[model samples]
Target: MKRFCFTAVSLLVVPVTILVAGPAGNGECIRTPKGDITIHIINHATFALGWSNLTIYVDPVGPQARFAHLAKPDLVLITDIHADHLSVDTIREIITDKTLFVVPPAVAEQLAQPLCQRSTVMTNGQAATVLGIKIEAVPMYNTTRQRLQYHPKGRGNGYVLTLADTRIYISGDTEDIPEMRALKDIDIAFVCMNLPYTMTVEQAASAVREFKPRIVYPYHCRGSDLEKFKALVGTDLGIDVRLRDWYNK
Candidate 1:
């Protein structure tokens, strides 16, 4: 991979307000043209972000004992039925009468009674508009033959959300599939990298190099060398890598 050659002066200036919102704390929002995108990092593989009244909680599990400050999600997205991604107890705690729950079919089957009433089931290639945000479901899975059964093709989904003019991609548990590399004009991306569940740091960096995004946040990456991830992007791609301490445990 070629080292990033752009000078510091050439890089686009991200406003101080956007960066001031430290990884920890409430009301720490990133102001965008669409609205304020506030992020709260609870712990490993669990975080919450809200934009324009549309709150999105991803993989909302892990140490539920400490998430008292999290607001109820307007939209909850569960990528899979894994305990880290789908905690019935945590979902139940945050769910309200109006929350629009989005999950894969596997997860939807796990829900019982009233929780199922307010949920939307989406598979790969499906899409829906929830709270004015256009959500498109894309395929997410592993290509390595041995690991194919973990996340079979066409069973799970990675989401691409278009909010106002910003396009964001949230890669659920997946390897560096061709479909992800073919994505065009992605403004922001939240990618995953972990062993035995998702791609390696090199694979994630290669995918980002192909489909460049304005900004990239590496989350849901546990027990992996994140410095390698940052170095790969800094030395190979034009994509700006924003590091957040989501896994400080």
Candidate 2:
């Protein structure tokens, strides 16, 4: 429900003062052929995606007040079962009867009966056309044996949303897996990079270099060095490495 604002901010990777929107330096709205897609970078992995009148909230894991400025979502996508990615209390407060909960199997199993009834469970490689949008569940897991328990291969998923002609990939907690590197026609990608939980900055950069998305935004990078990530991601690879403020209290 908040009004949109426009501004140009200089980022380390892109020299031309990238165009960004909204009060927070993190949020930006990208114009498309159909309509503009507004990315509200709430915090950490939590963010809201808006196009036209429809709103999609992804991994809303923070306090209720954090979401107060945004509009009530028509659809909510919970990537994984982790608390940082799925907050039960936060869902209860924001979700209405009309709101559809799109979640993975593990999350659907833990949800209450009423909430579970309103939810759609999608496994890896499965595709669902919900609310006029095509959502495909992609594989997400840790490659290292030590971090395997953090995110099992088939237990969770990363989602690829085809919003009009633009295909956006929201990577759930995952390492630089082969599946991620194999993605095609990805216009915008939100990749994760955190120590012990996900891949390192170098690994993330390497993966993006392989896939070569038009724009890559770094989120869920609480302890990771994003400056190094930007430096590692050269423009010659044809990727825009956007750095956002994900850690602000």
Candidate 3:
């Protein structure tokens, strides 16, 4: 039930807090109209969000044991077909009979039997409502001409999930594209920044400034400079830039 406190300083990287003050829980909390949402960062692009009795897992991969400390998921969202984003083994280990999935069409093609049956395929710019949350599949891809093959437009998704009155944006793997820069009224955002795949830290910061989320968390950043990212998204914008240990696997 604890919340993170931020100052008016230009750049702040608050340490990750264990919301329930226990060894099993490791995440930060965000207040919503319905209840508090806990963000559990498992690793790279894998994380879980818990609000009320519902839990949503995003890009769950790696060993099943990696997710031992988090709450089970009621909904699962796969952003792309990359190995890190979609793993049949991890899904099999965590899914229950009642679990549902929301995925891009490319990701859906890779799922088998039951998981496929339980999934709803969403294309870029499409919207759906699941488990009381408004889900919008935003475009995520590489912008540079040479890097276009890494993540072609319409192949992957960046999600915009509206929980109660709070809006959360999860950038799967992308560059600073027009769609990302045009986002409006976002409460929390989880953006990606890594070379040879996603954008550079400078590009990521520029995109964040355009959208201006109240709180922004740099995630899926394997080797990008966190300090530079925080500085680029300066205090003048009144944006709270959080730097977490995403590679703490």
- lDDT top scorer: 3
State the C-alpha lDDT per candidate: 0.74, 0.82, 0.83
Error of 3 at 175 (Å): 0.4
Model with the higher lDDT, candidate 1 or 2: 2
Candidate structures ordered by lDDT, highest first: 3, 2, 1
lDDT string for model 3 (1-249, tens) is 222211111211122221221232477777554568888888999889987689999999988898888778899999999898989889999889898898887887787766777777788887777787778888999989888889999998899887777788999999999999998888889999998899999999999999998889999899899999999999998888888887767
Q: Write the per-residue lDDT of candidate 1 for residues 24-105, one digit (tens) a residue.
A: 3464565565466777766666777777766788777855565666667888877887787888987777677888777777
Tell me the spans in candidate 1 whose CA falls farther than 4 Å from its real position: 1-28, 235-237
Winner on lDDT (2 vs 3): 3
Q: Report RMSD (Å) for each prediction in the order shown.
A: 10.3, 9.2, 9.7
User: What C-alpha lDDT does candidate 2 achieve relative to the native structure?
Assistant: 0.82
Deviation from native of the Cα of residue 176 in model 1, angstroms: 0.2
Residue 62 lDDT, candidate 1, scale 0-100: 57
In terms of lDDT, the poorest run of 10 residues in model 3 is: 5-14
Across 106-223, the per-residue lDDT of candidate 2 in tens digits comes to 8877788777766777888877777877788889899998998899998887998878777888999999999999988788899999989988999999999999888899999999
Off by over 4 Å in 3: 1-25
Looking at model 2, report the run of 10 residues with the lowest lDDT sum.
7-16
What TM-score does candidate 3 get on C-alpha atoms?
0.89
